[model samples]
Target: MTDQPAAESTTTITLHLWLDVVCPWCYIAKRRVQAAIGLFERPHDVTLVTRSWELHPDLQPGTGGPVDHDARVPGESVAPGEQRVRIEEAAVDHEIRFEWARAVRANTFDAHRLCALALELGGPALQSAMVERCFAAHFTEGLALDDHDVLQRISAEAGLDERRVAAVLASDDYAANVRADEEAGRRLGATRVPFLVANRTASASDLQSVEDYLGVLREVVTESA
Candidate 1:
């Protein structure tokens, strides 16, 4: 018999991402992660597990002001106009459209719950679609993240079951999952949004470039191999 080469074994890398829906930085970081994954050698072997992190968790749901140059979380101080400028500059090449004039700063708890529901019902792909929808609605389309009707429409757009989504919105379904995700992020020493971890070992924080994310993914892949 002719000798044959051994088959390559695939190793799975679990990537955990903690983000808030309203965070512009998180949106940018997410795009960077996706870009890095596309450049990875074994992209299919990598699994993304999205988690929840609330930048303004204590803010009342459905209560928010119009997003503007001066918009900021209560009790947190920042130089006026600096934030908008900085984020716009950072996101210039990432295809993000701010639409800040029409944006609202509503609490993202309900959106996080909807994401949890997506994760429960369909897994990471579906959950990512749900998150992307929420992000686009809030950031690009200028929709309120906490509005139930908008959420219903978003959920439907993401191909989730309408009845289940309605149930999730009417009641507190997946709230515990959302809380657990936040608690997990806190335990991981994450003090801010857009926290990412690969293989439960390597981690990166806000605003890292795509190359930085690619480096972290390479470390995970190499160590696993």
Candidate 2:
């Protein structure tokens, strides 16, 4: 369990998370964060919300060329063979799945747009489901994230209306929001995938350890508690 200073009984704690649906490490971190928060006695009060971010927003409908850019230009690595295996292993360690077949890194802007809609509708739970479905479709099933057929399946699975999602993807409903997220990330100094910020106070330099993350969180939450 985690610990923070006992509060004055009036202050409220909120945790805002920044993440992208296609980022594997961000997905892993989510689970670890969940586990750590579970250690708290009343974690329900430690609210969490996910903000949209894109790892490769410029990625075209069919992109991420091979293991090398040249190979990727010609065509993607087939289901990313060994790469897919490694991703699945990483996910299993965290009790998750990463289904993006390294070969296909489709444009995620539309997906992020839908996520913004989900955020406004149901908050974290709905978006989390959508992220999981996207990961499974991209990594395990090797489906297209931009394909209407595949996205419809994912939307339906995530409890969103397939037809509604199809329309959202086809148009630019949340395009501005997606661009805003990208701009905000840039402003926040995020230059790479898996970048994380805690309470806008502390961030790990490389791959972060939960202990260090918790330390930062505790430092911020307790000081204000």
Candidate 3:
């Protein structure tokens, strides 16, 4: 009789990000994480992807109320003028533009779909372009990305076919995938956007310090060995 042996299993850690189109911090976090990865001696082994998490799903266009202040955020309402000064000061630390005066946040479900479609069509390059567009749409152009039309234009600008992006944004062609990501986010207890997960563990991929993130990723790589 021959003895049977157990099979060995191997798996790679996938960092799943739960993001909202209007969330500016997620963009900064995005760049920081990529920078950290590049700094890693073994940057080739990590996989990164964006997941859908709308900041304002129920929001409607034209009727949505502006944030309490121009360039001032709406959490605990403050005088918009006063908030601007504070935001300007905060900008120095964040080293990113908030430009809230021009920002008009909306439902990002369609935008999320567009991103997923881009991933399917052209891999990470397409996704990278879309990410840049999304950040510009919010921070630079102050355009509403939640709108299908806006998303379509941005997608094209990112080199994605207009018709293809239109088709993807028309309905939930990739809603199931987005939903799956969201479900995974929920399972991992990501209460905020920009949640970061490494390997098979469910860790919040949201806004985190760059050094802290690098430490976590390195630990995962070491443990996997």
Best by TM-score: 1
Q: Write the per-residue lDDT of candidate 3 for residues 1-225, one digit (tens) a residue.
A: 111111221335566667776776577677767766676555676677777887777787544545443443433456647755654553455456766777775667777788888888888668777877887788778887766677878899988988888777665699887788888888887777778887754354445656656666666655554
Once model 3 is optimally superposed onto the true structure by TM-score, how far is the C-alpha of residue 47 displaced, in angstroms?
Answer: 2.0
The RMSD of every model to the true structure, in order and in angstroms, is 5.7, 5.6, 7.4
TM-score order of candidates, top first: 1, 3, 2
* Positional deviation of residue 7's Cα in model 3 after best superposition, in angstroms: 26
Top-lDDT structure, candidate number? 1
Cα lDDT tens digits for candidate 1, 1-225? 111212354767888999988888888888889888888777898888789988778888778888664545222567877778778887898898888887888888889999988888899999999998988999889898989999999999997899999999999888898889888888988888789999887898766888888888877655655
Give the alpha-carbon lDDT of every model: 0.83, 0.61, 0.68
Location of the lowest summed lDDT over 10 successive residues in candidate 1 = 1-10
- Over 4 Å off, model 2: 1-4, 7-11, 63-92, 98-103, 202-206
